[model samples]
Target: MVSSSQPLASLIGRKILDQGGNAADAAVAVAAALAVTEPCSTGIGGDAFCLFYDAKSKTVKALNASGRCPEALTIEKLRSLGFEGDSVPNTSAHSVTVPGAAAGWVDTVDLFGSKRLSLAQILEPATELAERGFPVSELTAQFWKRGEQRIMNASPNGHEMLRHGKAAPAAGEIMKLPNMGKTFRALAEQGKAGFYEGRIAESIVKTLGDLGSTMTLDDLKNHSSTPVEPISIVYNDQLRVHECPPNGQGITALIALGILDSLQSKGKRAFLDAGVNSVSYLHTVIEALRLAFADSKFFVTDPEKVHVPVNELLSKEYLAKRAELIDPQNTKAVAHGSPANSSDTVYFSVVDKEGNACSFINSNYEGFGSAIVPEGCGFVLQNRGSNFNLDPNHPNALAPLKRPYHTIIPAMVTRMDGSLHISYGVMGGFMQPQGHVQVLLNMHHFGMTPQEALDTPRICIMPEEEGRSVVLVEEGIRPGVVEGLKALGHEIQVVTGLMRANFGRGQIIVRREDEESAGGHVLVAGCDPRCDGIAVAQF
Candidate 1:
């Protein structure tokens, strides 16, 4: 089964699986295809993360393929550029980090891919999609249209992404990216060096440099993917939820789940027994997440650059202490506890017939990234560095060769018996972990199917002045629940008509292992209705 934000990309993943590729290969193919189909959200110029479940070992492994800042770029440089702010401007060239997705793609294949398929073969489908062109999906077209001005005015080579160098492509219009195809072919033929060393690397460095960015070819050459042990927390004693470690914010989901578990242990049933989407249920989940965010936002940074107390934060004792702060009937002001913590982008799930699963996410921070297309590279440079805080004392503050806080994450859930249960993720800046918590509980506690879990009305806790939170409830949520939340002193905003994308787009593939089932496993998948995507199963 393959599920992703773009239907054509999902088909490419399915094709890879049929062609004797494993989940890792299918995932990379989908990642590349999405780069062609959904250029507004992801590309080679961005970053990617993967959580792969190796069926044979029954262990989840993580790959942090996010890029680092240019070694010469600094807060002082931005200050000298006459910008005095807590963070770099969203579209500034200085915000362009080393593009990690290209190397990340090659690394995932090299590390977890089936040896049967060559890199060139795995990427050929996406390369073809880019060269031959495809009709633009409706939602993708809307997002592309929204970013048109940004690409045109802010990007030097922005005309490359535009239709005829002027307007955004309308839905159903065939859009071709021959330049991106050339980039893909270069990668296929030369592997990692094809992207990071030769013509493509020179183009990226020269383009950003002309825009006053300090990025150099060496930054691209030095980039490599880091594989780490995935961090997870046992949920409901039945399953374990896995996420990438700090600098990626996957820990935020674990911390939130841990807090909820602590609440359940303390006799808080409203979080579960009140039924899904009820005022009590939503309120409790929201409050727990708020507390989790309090911790994650304070502690989640590059662990290599700072000490992140991952063990202490996920410890049962600390979670119990944090759960004590939650009010069943109302919201509360929460702060970072000593224990510690923690989007944009594309999230997809792939599960091969052999039970190997890959939960993957890739992204360019914000739409079209910094909106700066690298000369002939046919992709936007990710403004991931825009996530960095300018306060010199902050742990996530911009520093030479350091990764800023990353929003894109991939997730997986495994049963206690060490079998893959679900491969999934929710993609959107800040809404990611929150979506993970809601969707997981929808299935684990309420017994909803994968589709039901994704279709349910979602709520996002948007930050407001003075640390207050305004809950953005999707349109389908009952009106009484909205009023009930407001009465509890929670600020409420009902989102509808296109603005709801802020809540996020998610994908899920649930694995049911049964000796009697076909191939001893049944794969059920769901794609987000909020975007242009689908879930397909291959026999």
Candidate 2:
């Protein structure tokens, strides 16, 4: 089964699977295809992260494919350019980082792919689509059109992203990215060096330099993806949930789940019996997540640059302490617990016939990413550097050659014996972990299927802005539950229609390997109704 927000991209991934490629190969294929079909979320100019389950070994491995800031770009450089306040401009050339996606793709294949397929073979489907063009979907077109003016004004070479050098084409219009196709073809023929050391790298340097950026060719060449052990927590002693380590927000889900487990242990909680949309269940989860975000924001940074105490934060005793802060009857802003733990993005998963599953996510930070495109590159340079904290005392402080705190994370669930059970993720700026926890609980505790899990009305605890925070809920949530949450201290906003995109667009595929369904596995797939996406399964 292969599922993505874009139909053509999903079809491309399934094509790779049909050709005898493993899940890892199909993952790269899907990601590359989505780059062509959904430019508003990801590109070769961005970064990626993955959680891969090796069916042969019953082990889960993680890859942190995110990039770091340039060696010469520092807080002082921004200040010298008259930049003010505690943040950098999202649209500035300075916000661009050395992209890690292309290098990451090669590494994923090297480590997990089968010898039956080469990088060129894996990428052929996407390369064809980018060269020949595909019709834009309604939701993606709406998203793309919103960024047309921003891309034009902020990027020196942004004129290339337009239709006839005017506005973006509407939904159903065929859009061809010949330059992106050219770049993909180069990667296919020459491998990683095609992206890191040759024409692609030169375009990166020349374009950024023209826009007053400090990025250089060497910075592009030096970037490499790291293989890391995935971190997980056994939830309710029945299932284990996995996420990548720091520099990404995967831990936010673990921390929130840890707290919920603690609360459930206290009887102090109903677990899930309060009804799916009950005010009590919603309040409990929201408050726990708010607390988790507080800690995640305060502590998560590049592990190479800072020490994030993952063990101490996810510790049962520590999580229990954090859970103790939640008042089941009411809601309020919760503060961070001692340095504990832990966007415009795309999330997709593929489970091959052999049970090897790849849960992957890639992103260009925010919309159209710095709104900057390299000359003739047909992709946006990510503004991930804008995530760095300007405070010198902060752990995520802006520095040379260091990664900023990341928000994109992919999640997976495995049975006690280490078999892959669920591969899932939710994509939005900060709604990811919130989606992870809710969808997970909806399935595990409430017995909802994958579709029901995603269809449930969601809630997001917005980051604290100037010490004021609000909880945004979808309109379909029962009116009584909304009133009850407001009755508690929550300053609630009910988002409706297209605005509900703030919640997120997610995908999931569940695998069943029980005796009743032996020999062949049953693939239950679900795609987010909020976006123009579908899940495709092939037995």
lDDT of each: 0.88, 0.86
Q: Write the per-residue lDDT of candidate 1 for residues 192-216, one digit (tens) a residue.
A: 9999999999998888888899988
| Backbone clash count for every predicted candidate, in the order shown | 5, 2
Q: Using alpha carbons, what is the TM-score of model 2?
A: 0.97
Model 2 stretches astray by more than 4 angstroms: 336-343, 516-520
- TM-scores for all candidates: the values are 0.98, 0.97
The TM-score, computed over Cα atoms with residue i paired to residue i, of candidate 1 is 0.98
Model 2, span 499-534: residue lDDT tens: 778888899999976666755668899898888888
